[model samples]
Target: MLTLYRPGDGPWHRLPAGPKSLVLLVIVLGVSLLPATWWCAAVAVGACVGCYAVRGAGMRDLLRQVVTVRWILLVTLAGQLVFTGPETAVANTARVGAAVVISGLLTLTTPVSELLDVLERAMRPLAWLRIDPQRAALTVAVTLSTLPVLARLEREVREAQRARGGGRSLRLFAIPFLVVALKHADALGDALTARGVR
Candidate 1:
């Protein structure tokens, strides 16, 4: 999956990070709320396309990037088709698939720093709840950063497994990844503490 952040200086980069985070939730909810009809999906797609364009994204680039998560999108679409009536299957699947792509566009347009800034801002109210806002923001940052780290490790491990013909064994793959993730998680916690984010 593509990350939501990149170094940039566009208008999106200048916008308050707090508002952008809410947008992620809005995109998913708005997409899911539409009726399972061809016209609705078409409208959703058009709306999403407009949002992307407003954020300076090209249609081809958007489509090309969504290829990373196509499998998940396909599975979702397939599930909707099998359960929903055949008459509405195509429309439903299209809507679901388009929604995923459209929502993903927000990530592509927004930088991850903006995300952490949003996280920090959003968690401010936690102080009233006796929660440490810095700790909360650090937690969110760790969570966000892990996806990329794990993806890197998985790619490396999968390559090594394929070399040794261990790729076919689910047990071999899962165990190593879990072990590495645990070790990394501990180190991350230590780093956060050292930085006084806790």
Candidate 2:
């Protein structure tokens, strides 16, 4: 579910990131902004999983993925259920959340390189505007890659602080990530400049 290092030799794993990203964007936007309906939502989820199955994804691995992402979706769905009529709210929550889950499924199925390629192809139209699309795509891809690393760093930092008798607070969680991000951003910028990529 965390999708740490689920490497495989499947066709999806070989897909370029750019096309996969395009598919993710289209599906997420379509499913999220469309009408709220339980049946529709169920179909969307099934379609996502179907893609995995077609690509030879196993049940246990997919279940782990669902478990990893379900925590937030479940909480949101719970709140939605409490605030609105059960029938309407439940349907709407499922529709919206299924979109999110589908997007995650795309990410899990597609490799990051494929995502980059997708982005590059997408940004081709903007070439007339003197935009470096690959650079832009790389920026996004790099940010995505950094998310888990930063999360892990934040967890380690918090645990170290707690071990030293530090109290829990949002600030403790926020500060370490922000500081680390800033430092890394600077280093990345410097590297890009050195390579004439900036």
Candidate 3:
């Protein structure tokens, strides 16, 4: 699998995973609680960009995060434009983009193992409720790891379609993407099972 963790000696990279995750959660929650306005969205997105700059992330890295969710943003913008107005559409799209960028930054700065460790520690108190902390952490690990893989798969599929002179058809893209994603899921399941994760 492709790792999202970028090695760096930056402050974000040096910070412990627990507090970093808490800050991420707080930012997302705070943004969600804000009114859906252009200023709110702009502030959220601008803050994420500033964080990237502070962490010494290049423009390319920031663009990659935006590119990965371009389709989702387009759809959201279009839908909101139809139901609401252009301002709301822009605000909502920017909010979603900001959230994705923040999450991407977290994954880029923190290793999967560290994130899993934090999750496991946080979940320990729920053991009496029949919650398996290890399993919970595993689920998060799989999710965090799978996002980049899926994003890469999407780009590969899109390139293949372009090579075949195919246009941007969602149905065409979805079919092959889902097929490959399921194959990857199956292989991952087998690997995890072999390691006794199940």
Write model 2 residue lDDT over 1-198, tens digit each, in one string.
Answer: 134335677765666555655666787777676555667667666655665574536667566556555656678778878887765566666666556555655556666776677767788888899988998878876766665565566667778778877778777667776787788778878987898875
**Residue 150 of candidate 2: its Cα lDDT?**
55
In model 1, where do residues sit more than 4 Å from their true spots?
A: 1-4, 22-25, 42-71, 74-82, 86-113
Q: Model 2 off-target regions past 4 Å?
A: 1-6, 14-26, 53-83, 86-89, 105-111, 161-168
lDDT of all predictions: 0.66, 0.66, 0.83
User: Which residues of candidate 3, in runs, are more than 4 Å off?
Assistant: 1-3
lDDT of 3 at 180: 95
Which lDDT value does model 3 have at 124? 95
Which of 1 and 2 is the better model by TM-score?
A: 1
**After best superposition, candidate 3 residue 198: deviation in angstroms?**
1.2
Of the candidates numbered 1 and 2, which has the greater lDDT value?
1
What local lDDT does model 1 show for residue 152?
67
Candidate 1 lDDT by residue in tens digits, 1-198: 245455455554455556655665677678778887778767776766765565355665566645545666678767776788754665666566666666555455666666667677788999999987767876766665676577667767778889988846888988888888888889988887897755
- Candidate with maximal lDDT: 3
TM-score of each: 0.70, 0.67, 0.91
Clashes of each: 2, 11, 0
Rate residue 50 of model 1 by lDDT: 67
How do the candidates rank by TM-score, highest first? 3, 1, 2
